[model samples]
Target: MSPSLTLENIWVAGERAPRLGPLSLTLPAGQRILLAGPNGAGKSTLLAVLSGDLEGSGGTLTWPPSSAWAQRRAVLTQRNTLDHPFTAEEVVCLAGVSGATARAVLEELGAGAWAQTPYTRLSGGLARLVHLARVLAHLDQLDPTAAWGFFDEPLAHLDWRYAGAALRALSRRAAAGYGVVVAAHELNLAVPWAEHVVLLCAGRLEAEGAVGAVLTPDRLAEHWGISGHVDRRDEGAVLILEGFTEAG
Candidate 1:
């Protein structure tokens, strides 16, 4: 059976105020959830909590109890902090998966030649792809029914081509029954593949639901301080922001 992640009334307390939460959500394995909001909307904070990097006060977080989460859960942070001298392939294998698995994931993600590159010598975009490969390989090593992956600003440094490739890889992972949660600044890019959307404004959840329900122009204006429309394009529907609104 697929595992599920459940959060009840979760909130992160800052020194003087709440950094995030009072948010409740349940994500089952095999689902795709997108976290969307402007800067400082607590999208990163929520991802930290979900990834077990930060503890939230006043709420419950639960997942499968039998396995070590380090093996079942994977995370790709926005920044690539590895300045070590290891090769990119070594970095990926550090996720506890076999070296072969790591190599395959890197190749699949269009970073095939990156395997032998020194991690510290790679450009930001290439480094990000290497880390992306690590997380995917990590999750791929687990039972798909119990896998969970979280990505924060995954497309930050990626070029358009690699970003699109990353989306395809993520889609394949979710299709294979692994739960995936991604934080995206570009909501339009995520909307095409996201099964559900969670909107956070000023550390609060402004809206949460399936893509069509949560990604409306009205909600964008209210939560993101923008007047926009979901424009239907030849490829798919895209969120187009016409202008800024003072009424957020």
Candidate 2:
């Protein structure tokens, strides 16, 4: 079995309440996990902790050796600011990724045409794709075994087509034994491709399990304060949100 990243009693302090955790979970390689929750639900905080950008106040996070983890993991934040005049392809190659591999990743995500365009000249969505391609290209240079990628709101500015392409690329990485943890709000689009879901609410873990069990109507209403149902089809499960709850 591929190695698992384990967290035990993880906690992060905030000004008033905990920012996240006092939570625990095991993320195994080869699994795609969707981090689902409303705003201020700690999804971004959790990703930061897992990526080693933020330290937890308490508890242990265990993974492969530091050297291996540093080399094998990649992170894409919700917002990436690049003011320089670097071209899209240049931004991707900044990670020392080969020109061929960087262009290939951009092409895969429908951003090939903009490879030579200056980063500042691209739209928000296109720039987001370039950063994503950079992350994917960086991973491409690493060993896939036990590799992991954490993405925060990756679909933020993407159109349906590009969002689908990005999700597929992440899925491909998972299939190749890389663990993918995505912080997302687009349940309908994201849940279908993910193997597991971790639902958070107000900095606490509400539920964590397979998509079918954790994303039921009751749970949706409870955690997200919304009315929704999971429509399971041959393609995969789709989350249909009707409206907000009375408390929502």
Candidate 3:
């Protein structure tokens, strides 16, 4: 089995309250993990900690040594900014990938036509795709067996077709032994692609386990304050949300 990333009592402090943690979890290589929760659930904070962008107030995140870890992981945050006038392909090449490879990554995401387009000129969705391509391009140069990808709300600006394409690309990475972790709220879309699910509620670990085990209707109600059921189909299971739960 591939090695795993372990978090022990990880936490981050906030001005008024604990932003996240005291949460422990294991992220195994070659698995697709979905970090699901409502807004302000500390999903982005947790990803930042994993990506080494933010330090937790307490707890330890254990992975490979710093050197190897640096080379083996790629992160795509919810928001990206590039003030400089760089083309789409140039943005991807910033990840140390070859021009040809960068173009290929853009093409894979159906952004090939935008390769020479200025990043600042593209619409919100197009820019998001470009950033995602850059992240994936970085991972392409790593040892797949040792690689890890962390994404926060990657599906935000993508339409269904592109969203599916992006998920499929990430799934391919997992198949090649890259540990893929995505923080997202698109439960119906994300759940099918993930092998495991980690549900957070108000900065705490609400649940963590296999998708089938963690994403039940009752749990969704309790954690998401929603009314829903999991429809098990031959293809895969999907969350069917009916409405919000009435407040007590």
lDDT, candidate 2, 199-222, per-residue tens: 998899888888988898888887
Q: Where is model 2 poorest over a 10-residue stretch in terms of lDDT? A: 63-72
**Candidate 2: regions farther than 4 A off:** none
Residue pairs in clash, model 1: none
Model 3, residue 57: displacement in angstroms?
1.6
Give all TM-scores, in the order shown: 0.91, 0.95, 0.94
Q: Candidate 3 local accuracy as lDDT?
A: 0.87
**Candidate 3 stretches greater than 4 Å from native:** none
In candidate 3, which residue pairs clash? none
Tens digits of per-residue lDDT for model 3 on 1-248? 24688999999999888999889999888888899988989999999898888889999888644676569789999988677779999999999988899999988888899999999999899899999999998887887767688999989978988899899888888888888899988887898888888998889998888887888888888777888887777888777889999741
lDDT of 1 at 151: 92
The sequence of per-residue lDDT tens digits that candidate 1 reaches over residues 1-248 is 25778989999998777999888887766777788888999999998888878888879888634667686778998776678988999999998877788888888888988899899999988899999988888877777877788999877788888888899899888888888889988776788768778888889988887776787888888777898877655675677779999998
